[model samples]
Target: MDQRWEDAVFLHWRIPVPAAAARMPPGVRPDVVDGSAWVGLVGFRMHRIRLGAAVPLPWLGSFPEINVRLYSREPDGTRGVVFLSLDAPRLAVVLGARAAGLPYVWSQCRAVGPGRSDPGVGYDVRRRGGRTTSAFAVRPDPTVRADDELSVELTARFGLHSRFAGRTVHVPVSHEAWTLHPATVTHVVDGLVAAAGIDVEGPPASVLYSSGVRTRIGRPRTVRGT
Candidate 1:
């Protein structure tokens, strides 16, 4: 699959390892950073989704998405993301991803702004079947470099860890190094994180933004002996 993620906002919080671990699927464990595991709330617009290298599917190819996710690694040190829930506007996308054993939920979602300034973006998400919702505004610093150690660790993920057919699978994805910017959360009303079963008591530990990147997700490979 090929797609582009635009005007992304990343909100991260450092939580106890147990809080993060409790939500992971089998065959992977929470990846600790600075003695705690981090969970992220990411919102963006997914654009031009195509199968393999095929033409983008109309309507189905573009939408707004917000996900609650965490970092993980296989026993062999392969790092990836473990999504607790992905809330998207398209039911087709929700169903398609769920069929593959990913946690995708249909939602009412929108990404607005970049407003008069390139960095001020707004996001809103509300799950269809439940009351999970989120709204936030951010100001991104275009000059911040993404090469810093923490930034690299957070944004350079190479794959996703999913639970499929009673097995844990790893789906590889490739994208150019993100050009990230420092961001400040100007406003927020979130429940998506708590809905994912992780308790974030205070403010986010890290807030970052990106102009975004084009990406390709490859086939899945089993990581657990199913």
Candidate 2:
């Protein structure tokens, strides 16, 4: 797969190791960083999504996406992300991803006010059943760069762990180093994370933004034992 993840907003909170690990697939555990586990609420626009090196699909290719994700690593040190939920507007995309074992939910997702210069970038996601939603905004400070350990750990995943058929699989993703900007949560009301079975209180612990990046998603390989 080929795609551009644009106008990305990442919000994370430190959680208990057990809390992050509880939803992981077989043979994978919560990847600990800074002495604890962490979960992320990542909202981004997936622009010009194409399969392999092909041209981007027409309208179905571009859409807004929100993910509730956790860090994971196998015992042999293959690190990846574990997505508890992925909300997007495209029904085709949702069905395809779910068929491949990803937890993608069909939803109506869009930007709150991307063109304006005031509140910066944001996304609003409402799932199909109208039971789950996330509306949030942020202001990216271009002057400051977020190069700390937690930010890198949360944003630099190169693959994902998912369950397909009767086995766990690892889907590799490759992208350049993210150009992350220090961002402040101007306003937010989120429930996508909680809907996936984790509880996060107050504001996010780490907030970062990026213009975007192009990516290559690789083949899915079974995790050998599991």
Candidate 3:
């Protein structure tokens, strides 16, 4: 699969290792750094989705998305993301991803902008016929680059670990390093984290923003066992 991820707002909270590890698949564990594990609530626009060598689905493929995710690492230190939930507005995309074990929820989602009233970029997500929702915005400071260790660790992941047909599968992805800027939270109202079964107090520990990246996700392969 190939697609473009644009105008991403990355909000992350640090959590105990145990709390994150408990959510990992059997053979994978929480990826810990800076003495803790981190969970991210990321919002962005998904554009130009295309199957291998196929034309991009311009309309059906483009939509706003927000995902709650945790980091995972195998015994041999293969790092990846483990999504707890993905909120997208398109029902067709939701159904297709769920069939492959991605926890995609159909929702009313949209991307907001750096307009006159609100000079920050953000996203909004609300579950279909329900109350679960999340809204957040960030002001990226272009003067400073987000090239620190923790930033790279969170944004430069190359794959994901997921469950499919009772087995844990690893799907690799290829993408150039993201161009990130340190950011500050401008506004936020969230419930997606709670819906994802994670609890954290106060505001996000780290906030960053990026214009976007083009990604290519590879085929899934089973882990060594289970």
Candidate 4:
């Protein structure tokens, strides 16, 4: 069995509807040129949710706008879609994050495995520079459990030239009973960031770190038992 983890930090920000529309790259059209617009544009998908009750008349697909769906997560933890976005990736992450109240940027963490059947866990954090982002898996560590408590630490700095040092974000798993795949972790991390409402437009400038471990679980028996 094996485990894997990965972390990445990116710059992010929110722009007002008009400014955001003006900043839209070539061949891009915003659902609304005014008012509150939840924009999530990444490699995976772009979702633009309009904030109004007036529905468009039929035959307006090429007009570059669509009715936004209202989604919500209840206080009891039940989830439902209150609205919909044409952008699937944005729908999955940005709106989801808004409903969850999780921070959107600075860093992201993801953990997967035990196997395909296991539910993967992902997290995001906001931190100052100098914090280390980390992902790791260990075998025979019974102290870990799926859905274990996760946390983010924020440090303050003061100075004209104060720069951040990468912070470590910890992702803990229940058991190292399965292999960890880095790509899987990356996908989840990206989704979490998108959900946080970071407009990741244009090409992504990403740096990747890859690592893994292999261990022999057992050796063949030298002789038959009596």
Candidate 5:
């Protein structure tokens, strides 16, 4: 049995739409770009255990993508964190951008801590386009373990100019939880697209699957209207 209790940490960051478009790696596919044309930042941390090692290793990476839509409904102008899988880095970026109300090309600072103590690693996102954007730091949260599962927490501190200013929401989001893996991520994203009333072809309207404890939602349907 793979005794590795891996934890994936994700942070949401916001930036301007034009800046986000600029960050696109040339030839941005049409399907990847949402009609809304929003942009946001997503930071990912993959925590895994090295073979025969006592401690878990962390790999850091980030991607910028457009946010299509959010699942939960909140009061107008109310801020809250939405949990999502790390499978689609680009999707996460887009979602974050939409949530922050900024353009796509913006980048943000990221930091990783050294164990449970010490300040942690810090860095800022600089606009490569001759514009001087302010920098900020993020603090890492302690690790919490529950039986075979473990989770880590963190908070992102953005500059005052950030779109998320005056509103800070922290949510505990888990990525690709075991059995849910890649298939689960696909199912959820597809469901979201359908629920938004977007027209998509093929696939049934509902799907059912067992994941250890109980059956969960895994349906894919074609939307009638775009």
Candidate 6:
């Protein structure tokens, strides 16, 4: 599958390694840096979701999405993300992703801003059940630089660990190196993390933004330990 993510804002919080490890599935442990692990709440607008060489379908091709993610590492040094929940406005996408063992949920979402060329953007997500919700606005610095240690640590993930058909699996992903801008969280109100059983206090440890990335996600392979 091929997809483009645009006007993305990444909000990451430093949490105890054990706090993140306790939620990971079998075969993967928390991928910690400096004795701490990170969890991220990322929001973006998806575009050009295409299958094979097919043209991008209208509604299916575009939507707003938010995901709750954690860092993880396998025994052999492979690093990846573990998604706790993916909230999207498209029901078909929600259903399809869940069929593949992703924790996708139907939600009402909106993404607005001056656009990619602008320095700020806002996102809002409210799950269908109305129990889970998130809202935030980001304003990125004008200067763009290659990611620093903390930025790279959070965004350079190459794969994801998930359960499919009752088996732990890894799905590889590839994308161009991200050029990030330091950003500020202008405002925030969230329950997405708590909904995932993660406890985060105060504000995020890091806030970053990028125009976005074109990503290609590979097929899943069963984990060796599973």
Please give, for residues 36-96, the per-residue lDDT of candidate 2 as tens digits.
Answer: 8989999999888787878768777678899999999998999999999999888888899
Give the alpha-carbon lDDT of every model.
Answer: 0.87, 0.90, 0.92, 0.25, 0.26, 0.88
How well is each residue in 26-114 modelled by candidate 4, as lDDT tens digits?
Answer: 22223321233333221111122222223332221111111112212223232222222222212244454444332223333233333
After TM-score superposition, the amount by which residue 76's alpha carbon in candidate 5 deviates from its true location, in angstroms, is 20
Cα RMSD, model 5: 18.0
Top lDDT model:
3
1-226 per-residue lDDT for model 5 (tens digits): 0122222222222223443333322222111222222221223232232323343333322332212222221233222222221123333444654565443443332333323564332223333352423222233333422222111111211111112333323222222333311111121112222222333444322111111111121211211111
Model 6, position 171: C-alpha lDDT score: 95
lDDT of 6 at 45: 91
Comparing 3 with 4 on lDDT, the higher-scoring candidate is 3
Give the runs in model 4 whose Cα sits over 4 Å from its true position.
Answer: 1-15, 33-35, 40-108, 111-122, 125-226
Of candidates 5 and 3, the better by TM-score: 3
Worst 10 contiguous positions by lDDT, candidate 2: 111-120
Model 6 over residues 99-159: C-alpha lDDT tens digits? 9999998889999794657657878988877887889988988576746887888898889
TM-score of each: 0.95, 0.96, 0.96, 0.19, 0.25, 0.95
Model 3 agreement with the true structure over 79-146: per-residue lDDT tens digits: 99999999998989999999999999989998998677755899988797767878899988878999
The sequence of per-residue lDDT tens digits that candidate 1 reaches over residues 64-181 is 8999999998999998999999998888888989999988988899887887646588689877765778998798877766567787788789899998888999999999998888
RMSD of each: 1.5, 1.2, 1.3, 23.4, 18.0, 1.7
* Candidate 5 to truth, TM: 0.25
Model 3 Cα RMSD, 1 decimal? 1.3
Off by over 4 Å in 6: 53-55, 115-118
Model 3 steric clash pairs: none
